[model samples]
Target: MKKSSMKNRLRPLLLTAVSLTVAVAVSACGPADEGAVSAKPTAAGVEPSTGRPTTPQTSPSSSASSRTTASRSPTSARTTSTSTPTPKQAIVKNTAAPRTRAAWPRVTFARLTFEIPPGWTLTTYGSDACVQPVHRAGLPTMFDCAGIAIKSGSIAGNELRSYEARQPGGWYAATDVQPCPVRPTLADGSFNGITSGTSSPPVESGLRPVGSRKAAYDRWTAACTSGYRFSPQAWHLPVSRVLFLDYTGHAETARVLESVRFPG
Candidate 1:
């Protein structure tokens, strides 16, 4: 019975050795890139892992793997981003217009509009009410000025026009625009008689035109301490003549004149 028992133990060990040898041999013949066979340890030239070769998903363009093993079909994780919205702005429409105003005394002298000094009177140099515009002799040619008719009361432009038409060009010596100095301020620092004082009324502004500007530009200065240099566009009408009244004078008066605007 002891001898039979020894035989039995030896037979079991032999059977175990045979089984392990066959399993290893079968695994060596299978696809190496598939499954975990590549991880099985071996001695010498034993077959590598059966898992398919795996590739690093470094970039979409890369197709090669680091080693032969089971391959993992690349799982692409693609994500997209959205944009943000912007705010709206409010707009205002400009529908209002600027207003133009007319100042008083829109008075006429030598067929020009000008500011008259308060408490002052004007008189004509000639006996005929319809004589030509003449000025005091010995004054600068560019400083042309006429003694306007302001007897008893200021003459209405309409009333004067009617009376003037009795003669040619509305006056015995009908005159066109004269080259008056811009302001009464003289270059030689002389005012003949021009002087200034406070408590005197503020200067009223005037506007005039300079035409197409082909005429000679004779710029000169004289004494009109209270007056200013002025210019304007001239438009002659059948019954009315257009003359721009521009002049430069004292500092304060010049400031007011700058506000006058020209039309297109």
Candidate 2:
């Protein structure tokens, strides 16, 4: 009977131990499939694959495309760098000044011919052919050097007798004159008694334009021989080729100006 009681006790304990082990095994294995499913979808970014989830080769195609893009960037940059060019800029320069003529024409008296430049005015002498024309009217007079009158026409001269000393035009006498003993250096520069004196020493004469081509001035003086005459006879001719003809208290400056003599 004791042996039968002991066997009954051992059987109850074994049943209790078997129940605890079964509870432990169920707890350990619970929801393992759910965990695997949730983790697979998170890694894929879209949905879990029906095939192998552990494969590492899914993103290689995108990586290869990125490498190709990076490789082409250097070549594109070089092409852009080689295309542009710099243009040469032109330099600005200064303007030059106007030039002046150094020398002009000088000819002997016998060969001189009448040639007038443009803009020269024509004037009449007294009773003769001597004509007067004024150019560069503002120039200083040869004798006075002071600002002379800028007359394109007539004026009076220094008086010698009772006759009117007024000249017809601003320059040159056109009158037929009697030869007085005075020299070509008019007035002989001798003021004492202009009455009856010998001729003056020959010197250059004539009133020329300041920058005229004729080159030199003709100078002379005039006086009466008898003192009874109304007009003075002695006269001065500064230059013959180019001349300043003075008559009736007027003086005319005649000069030849031309670039080239047209063979007439």
What are the TM-scores, per candidate, against the unseen true structure? 0.24, 0.22
Q: RMSD for each model, in Å, please? A: 15.9, 17.3
lDDT tens readout by residue for model 2, 60-103: 68767977889999988988887666677988776677687544
Off by over 4 Å in 1: 1-85, 93-104, 111-215, 220-264
Q: lDDT for each of the candidates? A: 0.32, 0.37
Give the alpha carbon lDDT tens digit for every residue of 1-264 in model 1: 999999999998999999999988988985666456645445334444467544423432342452222243222111122233345586888878867644423233344333433322333433212111234354322223322221112221221443221121221112233333333345786552322211122232222223222211112222335354332211122223222212232232222222222223
Error of 2 at 160 (Å): 26
RMSD of 1: 15.9
Give per-residue lDDT, candidate 1, residue 183. Answer: 35
lDDT of 2 at 225: 43
